[model samples]
Target: LKPLGFEGGPELVCQSLAEGPFGIESQADVDSVAMPLRKLVEGDNSSAAFVIACYSDPGLQVCREGTDRPVFGIAECGVLTALARAETFGVIAIAQRSIPRHMRYLRQMGLTERLAGERPLNMSVAET
Candidate 1:
């Protein structure tokens, strides 16, 4: 993000939630971080947009509800962008347990038809 922000590009700020599940493999994992994510988003007064960097996009709606600024979930953003330019798309997940959650979101967004497949690396954040 830093490298891409150079040469007068929009400044990007990245932050991690200090108190939440370190790795998200299930709904519980995503849920555990909701409050912390909301608090972080509400506290930050610097940026005009907020991005949930995690692939699982924990607390995306909560963050959006708390602010008028743009809120982006990387997974949703990537999927939407890919679908705009391609017929079908796939995702490489960090674990098999994450596939169901990912699929759920795709289904919720009515994008399951556009998804080609999802493959998991079966690795944790530390391993990656």
Candidate 2:
């Protein structure tokens, strides 16, 4: 990030959820963190933009709606980055179960045509 001209470097905020799952591997886990993530985005004033680090991009829409600042999801960023380099792209998912959800998201974004394929690592988020 510093090399990208962010002189001070980006601040990494990891907000803990009292009852949230250890990792966001499922849609249920994503749902559990949405509101909290929204609140974090709404409350932040120093950052120029918000980046959701999770591959699933929990609360990306809600966070964007709650703030005027740019909100970027890692998944979206990855796809766009891949597109910038090539006509089609592939995804490496953490688990097979995640493929369906990711496929659904790609369909919703109207980017399914750009996706060449997706393969799972068959491991937990922690393992990755």
Candidate 3:
């Protein structure tokens, strides 16, 4: 986003976030590849709104509780954006478990109708 006049950077919460075939294990663990982003708020250059990029929405609720910043997640994000663009869209999930998870997320977003379909790849996430 920086190149497009919006500043953006990547943060890794922990090594294990990507060690498994899935990028993350549990929700709390999403705060990964071993970085402490929470510190940014206390020092300087603090941001009021934050966005996380996991379908799991990891550490999101906790982050919200811990800070005053607004947070966003990618999986929920794409569904929201797509709702504005199209009434429905296909989800190409990496695993069978992801189908229900994604479905649940869409439901949480109140985007059930907007979710056109779920097509699980039926394999480990890395394979697809």
Candidate 4:
């Protein structure tokens, strides 16, 4: 836009609010979190895409279901885009307490074999 000489409107970037309504007690906070995203998309109120940034890839599946607008989660998008652009790719996540869960996600996404190898960062999610 800057190069095109078009000025942009105000922007909003909220984070760490997946639990907006459901919180941890619901154990499904993504459900609540996805509402605002879906509304903006469905209502045609968003000027740009939405990005969810939890390692869990919260609300990812349903968000796609709920909106036609593009949706992305950091880790999920990285791996998927990599696979789309390459024959193989590796995941370099911190080899911490979260390894099992990440491996499970890869298996679900059918990208386990894409893993050439792993270089454990050896830092726990909390530690990081």
Best by TM-score: 1
The runs of at least 3 residues in candidate 3 whose Cα sits more than 4 Å from the true structure, single-residue gaps closed, are: 1-22, 25-48, 121-128
Report the candidate with higher lDDT, 3 versus 4: 4
Residue pairs in clash, model 4: none
**Model 4 alpha-carbon drift over 4 Å, by segment:** 1-12, 18-44, 84-86, 123-128
- Model 3: per-residue lDDT, tens digit, 16-111? 333323455433344452234343323324455666665666556555565765766677677668777876877777656556666666777677
Each model's TM-score? 0.90, 0.81, 0.59, 0.58
lDDT of each: 0.87, 0.85, 0.57, 0.63
Q: Write the per-residue lDDT of candidate 4 for residues 38-118, one digit (tens) a residue.
A: 555466555466676665566687777877667788878888788889988866554344566677778888888887754
lDDT of 2: 0.85
* TM-score of candidate 2 against the unseen true structure: 0.81
**Model 1, span 26-125: residue lDDT tens:** 8998999988898888988888888899988899999999888999999989998998999999898888888889999999999999888787776545
RMSD of each: 4.3, 4.5, 6.4, 6.0
Which pairs clash (backbone N, Cα, C closer than 3 Å) in model 1? none
Off by over 4 Å in 2: 1-19, 123-128
Model 3 scores a TM of: 0.59
Error of 3 at 52 (Å): 1.3
Model 1 global lDDT (CA atoms, 0 to 1): 0.87
